[model samples]
Target: MAASCGRRRGRFAGGGGGPMMASIYSMVALVLVLVACVELGDAAAAVDVYRLIQYDLAGSPFGSRLASLNHHAGAFPFAPGADLSRTAVIIPVRELDLSFLRDYITNSKPLGGLLLLLPQKISEKIGQVRNILAEVEHLLLHANIPYPVYFAYEDDKVEALLMDIRRSDIAGQPATATTGGFKLVVSSSEPKKVTSPTISNIQGWLLGSKGEGDANQLPTIAIVANYDTFGAAPALSMGSDSNGSGVVSLLEIARLFSHLYSNPNTRGKYNLLFGLTSGGPYNFNGTNKSFSDVAKEMGVTLGIKHKKINVSNSRVAWEHEQFSRFRVTAATLSELSAPTELLESAGGLHDTGKLVDEKAIYRSVKLVAESLARHIYGHQGRNIDIFADNSNLAVNPHYISSWLNLLSRTPRVAPFLSKNDPFIAALQKELSEHTVEVHVQHEVLDGIFTFYDSTKARLNVYQVAGVTFDLLFLLVLGSYLIILFSLLVITTRGLDDLINIFRRPPSRKSKAV
Candidate 1:
């Protein structure tokens, strides 16, 4: 009887354990399958996020230049249609003078669009260039000329196209030469005229002392930076190179000075005024307005007791005037005759008002340069000799590229300043000196504005498929059903024995035996 009972218990145990084990195995497999699906879903989402799209401009014979023009110009009537436009005129930067532009626009046929090709060298004078372009556009609008205007920065493809066009038999010919052919067209919506114009200038001051005495009693120093750009449509003209660097540098100076001023231990005696004026590109419209406002607000005349430092990349230096001794590489010299080069060489520096002394200005500039050099190279740094004609100003040549919205790739050769640049490091150090008092005034002027129609400015939306909670819920539900089914099968198999044991009553007391 004992042997038979042991066999029965063993069979019951095996029957109950089999389904439980199988359920455990199923759960492990299901978990692994779910994990793999999740990983695959993540990979697919990542692919969708990183997808790239390529734009081709092979349809136009002028290629990228034509494409860029079309992109900037917006909508315009094309040739071989009702309009009898002749030449697709391209004006180089050198020939982009107001007179030249006006004449071209006035004389252009109904379908002919103007293309302005800018050179890399124009980076320094980008503000001036933008101003000139704006004037050109304004002239066109004022004259009611319906011709389209387009602009492109210099590139290899553009240069090639210019060379081909120049070498062609139709060079300098009339529009009839290339009539009825596919040509680049650029146009923009007519500008709205402003009748009641209200101009605002940004201005601020930082005082070294909290004295409420007469403003004339305190010595004043001003640091000025321009914060405006040539408003270009396609480019939006962020003014990176024009005054971006100067503004950034000035702000940094202000931050450092503000911290220093707050500390009682490092306070100075002189009052500092920091001005970030707008309208620099528009004949100093914003800057002049700011100075006037600042003087009136302070109730003091900025005169002999005041020192003003114009902090811009576009400053005139004595060294630039004596260009005979300056050494430029042959490669750079070859392009010196280009429009950008002519503009730079001829207009690198401008005259400041006679209020400041020349000798004092020279000494002050030298001191600043020397301080920078010392900070950059430590004791081993070369002496900065501003008096020498050969000494070049520490001005960066690629100021134009710094504008954030120029829509051009960085040049291969231009050495942009990084955190590692000695100039930046040294400038920071110099500004941190507690002896100097710095104040900053921030102002926003009219920006380089661009007009975009509904088509060109449309937003692109992308749809991506991802794992939803519903799918996960369904997976969990299926796993739970499998688990529950296994549990039910085990219970059903053991149900008979359990009932027999319970109903059999205490196995009749195998009495004394």
Candidate 2:
């Protein structure tokens, strides 16, 4: 049977292959090519990495400017006078050295890149180290880093790779072109300027009872909250509390008031305006001021400070400044004693749902809703509970929490958000449900701040070998070759002939052993 099969194969090969045979061979070759491609892809692991915020604030560069990196991996305790200009340092947040980092960045040290590894559950650890992380975040966000700086949350796969890299680093065998260590590669296009960044401001009106007069003629009470957040990493800036709680409070107030206006008996005489504004980090800020009095009555002291708008300062610090510009009365209600720094608390690395208290937002809703009800009914400073806990129109903690969580997960950076972004759409839809009318106004931000693209990237980590490793490998290979060659000489000739090669030619003056 073997002879017959061999004859058949030989005959088939000897003869011109048939169409079927050619098709089979072609398919096999294609599959082999696909397998080779698959192997190449498997060699590198991709990790989701968020790039440091990149933008030009009035032509002054801030954040990381570069967006691409291809360099060998490195860690702490680098050799003295080591050239890190070609090495991408991988520093875990657990081992973050703030002073060293600040010094390096402040001095504008040359570097291939920077990769900050955050814990998988950074939200869980932030509360304990808020101050430390805030300093790091504030420093990074405010500086103009020339090199690409990326942040990635650590996972099991990346942790394992990091361990290998640490071992290589400790062994004094950093991976180079010829060495075996990890190499981070992020292939991305050059970031381009965002053309005419626009922000959407959503507004709604809860029509008051029209008693023999035009409804538009009635006095309107506007409740506004800035919905956008700014931070070190635009992709992670979920402003849960800075303004999310305020935004949710406005929505909740709208809902409670909508119920009152739905019935003629309980309708207020004044119109209610709900505004979800953007660009809160800028001077065009959003205020939850109307909720302060009610909040104060409920054991929450909300201060409504009066900051004079300086038209010549060029920096708009408060959201109420815009209202002031139009000669309108407005106040920002905040729990903070003072104004936050440029990008502080507007949302950044540490502002997740974990830090936000849903009950706090719930309280804000009650404060605003009940206060407005009292003011309309001429019951100011009274103990009447318009939205009592057990009433059908009571404040909804679940509603506040759901909206808070949604905002906590959504990135609301105004420059990156579309005028009709789904988040904005959701806001519009919710307002339309609770108010008589809703409108979305899109405004192009003046050329004060220009933003760039490529907020996030996938870093491809590849294992590479070191120059020292290559040298050691060549030495072993050479030794093996010599032994194999010597064995060949012995088999072909004699043992003495192989031995003579290593014994060295006997000197004429001395007898060889």
Candidate 3:
């Protein structure tokens, strides 16, 4: 009997008498297995996210760019180009302090060309502005950047700059005058408003065609570029890194795409609009109206929506560092969310590198436009449309018009044909009658945005990247197994003790008798 007990002990310890120690070792091994499985699952999840990004960027002009991007996967590498046109009436509102731009140019290579849309109050400074602009341009010319530095004088500078251009008798007079000339003046007398008159005047000046028929019929794309402010109102108001960085990124992106679409290497198949908006009393005002107006036009436009992420904590430094060093890669409108999960598990635009430059936004826009155009039109000739949601600036065309009053002071309100009460009701009714399809991609952190196309009747749900649904599932399963296994070990140990007692020598039984 004693020998039997010893044999049982030997079974537990493998030719040793330390059965209890062996049981403890088994518990530790189980723990180690749990950790190993979790780590393995995590490694698998990271790999999946990488493949997903690659899959999303497979075809299009961006695909060519993607190879370079992939090589610098953890860095933000810039593509060479800017988007400006000879026939296009470019306008920029300099509301922020120009210190950032000035420093950007002085410290780094100056921006080759820019068409600034300045208010009338700053008209007197045209000479000073021109001198500074000239210096920037002169430097770029010296650098032989290949792209010409173009300028559009606005406000009083429009007439003033026109006189200067006409007097200078430059070689590229027509190209310079039309592209650089202030085509429309925001009549000094007009009230600040995005009024119909303003919209009409600016549209008439820039577009030269009237009605929906004349609007850029080519596939249209819109970008809703704005500052992603944190929850704090003051922070948003200050346009801190979130606001300033965000807007700069948008502008850079717009400039880049504008250049590409007009490039000789590229054929302009789509008409793209970059709406730099104001964040007013309301959230997302600029983009909302921009979207509404496009939908009302009944023209198909691809929409690329992007904003700054609230830098809530210092951890964002990593993202900033990554962004600064050019570790950040772009995604099409479809791929943006998915990567948010896989790369940055926190799922917000925190940069561990350098701050995301405005250039990144431009690159992203270019990529998205190229991809969508290719997807919709392919080799065949088809129009493309894109719409970007800006801030409330879209809603208050009047405010926008007032702001641009220095330029064409036309009261401009790009009203939402979609948000109009009557229109919404009509559309809702129309939608009920027709087979409209809606696609929604629910992100783990960010709320979902749905895409609806009545004409196609197709919908797809998108999941943002970086989110570990698979990893999450494995974690749950692995946890459950570990708990169950531990409990079973404890129960078996207890059972073995009972059996050993029963098999003990007969002395105890004889005493009981």
Candidate 4:
């Protein structure tokens, strides 16, 4: 048995490492080829991104036109003529230059995609960056951008990606197939047109005590407020102040009256109608009817701006105008003496909950409630503090803050809200608690304006290795493997055996023996 084993071992040694070496080299080569073909684009990261608004204005495309993105990252101050059509530019909102941006869009320059970085303190940025953002938003909203535009709050991960991209950009190396750099990818289906988007108007009526006549037939004191908001980005349009403040104030007033009207002894003679309208962002597209003070003691001024409604203007600026069009006697009490342009100030990027002053809302609520109560109780011009501090009728700061926070967190874009949206349901429920005959009317947004979906998406940013780098890596690896394979053959067998692989085998002297 020992002799047989020794002979087998010698036999194997004679052809030592030949078969094994060939097998190992083939495996190595296969692995190298596989590695070379592997793309490392998505090995870096993924981020949550809010897409820029994608909508149609009477068949005219506006805002960011694309929903999908797949391209390498390019940084701000991009090198001139850098083939932006294939590069996804990373622009910090802080570094935006309105003139250059306007020129870029106005001139119709093409880009693969754009990622706008928003500061973490988006709420605080209203005063500092509101103009810049609003201008940029207006520019982007009006123009037809054929590339994907996304907004991401600046965080550590995004900062890293931006730094990496900016470093490569500063080095004058545009991210491309041959040169490695960051790539942004957003995978989404084609944007579908939102069909028959519905905005529901919630209204409630509080009937007063009957004075030998039907209270329902009494003159209605209508308090109307449009609760919906629109913005460049639908998902980010948290209309915290515009109509949110108005809505909160209206609800508080309704609650106060519900308490008073609950008792016949304290009920007013005038019927109260509370209407919470929607589509106010679209010239008060949704309505029912109705129609502020506490300005003096709170160091607030009461100023009313009345802009004559041009019959030929064909645009409605204030909520009251929608009522006035129906010949209903209406007046607007607002801080703005002048109206904003179309789609302007309807809740844009700068509007946030943090900027909402609860005290201001509280004061407004108190003012309106007091004036309305005075008129109802036949003491409108009196200086008595009816809803005084710590009184049952006093405004609730907690309630105002709570509702304001809710509105701030909710995206009130009409087209995107569901038929039975929770926010709308909550509003309806709250109204039902304070008044009778609470009605919710769901109506399609009528007008030339049409909106598209895909208002939000996820963005994946990758630190990819370029094809050139991959090729070089494979080349070096292949060379190393080849050298190593040869060295193994020489050492395990002999130099003679390795040389014989390259040399032609000598022919035997056939039959010479």
Best model per TM-score:
4
lDDT of each: 0.37, 0.80, 0.30, 0.81
Stretches of model 2 off by over 4 angstroms after superposition: 1-42, 77-80, 285-296, 311-314, 468-513
Better of 2 and 3 by lDDT: 2
RMSD of 1: 22.1
lDDT of 3 by residue, 1-513 (tens): 999999888777642334455467667867877797565433111110000011111121100001111100100111234222222222233332345334434454433223333333333444454344333332322232211112222445344443443443343323233232222211112112112210000000011122345545654444433322211011101222333333333343443343334444453444544433322112233231122233233333545455444434212222222232342432223223323311111111121112233344443344343343444234323233432335311122232222222212111111211223342233233222211121111111111111111110111111122225446756976887666545554455555554564586779879899
lDDT of 3 at 237: 17
lDDT per residue (tens digit) for residues 1-513 in model 2: 999999989866643344345456556756765686567546568899999989887799999999999998888656767889988998887778787788788888888899888776666666555666678788888888999999888888878888888898787778777665788999999999889989899999988889999989998888888899988888988888877888889888889888889999888899988999988886563332255556667897765566777655556666666776677787766777777767677887777778787777777667767777888877877788889997899988888888888988899999999876899999999999998668899988767788998999988987755577668856975686567555555555568756776787768777744
What TM-score does structure 2 among the candidates reach?
0.82
Backbone collisions counted per model: 12, 10, 83, 2
Candidate 2 has its poorest 10 consecutive residues by lDDT at: 14-23
C-alpha lDDT of residue 357 in model 3: 36
Positional deviation of residue 411's Cα in model 1 after best superposition, in angstroms: 17
- Tens-digit lDDT string for candidate 1 (95-173): 5657645554467435344555665565356567646654653453234334434445566755654554444324332
RMSD of each: 22.1, 9.2, 28.5, 5.4
Please give the TM-score that candidate 1 achieves against the real structure. Answer: 0.34
Candidate 4: tens digits of C-alpha lDDT, residues 1-513: 999999999979867657687678768878866776565433577888888887777788888878999998888886556567888888888887677678778999888888888887766656768788888888888888888888888889888888887788678777897787877889998888888888899999999889999876788889988888888788888888877888899999999889899998999998999999888877778871111234464466776665677655557887778777777768766657877777888877777877778888887788778777877887744577878889987778888888888988888988888878888999999999989999899888975788888988888777777788888877987798778778878767779878888997555764453
Candidate with the larger TM-score of 2 and 4: 4
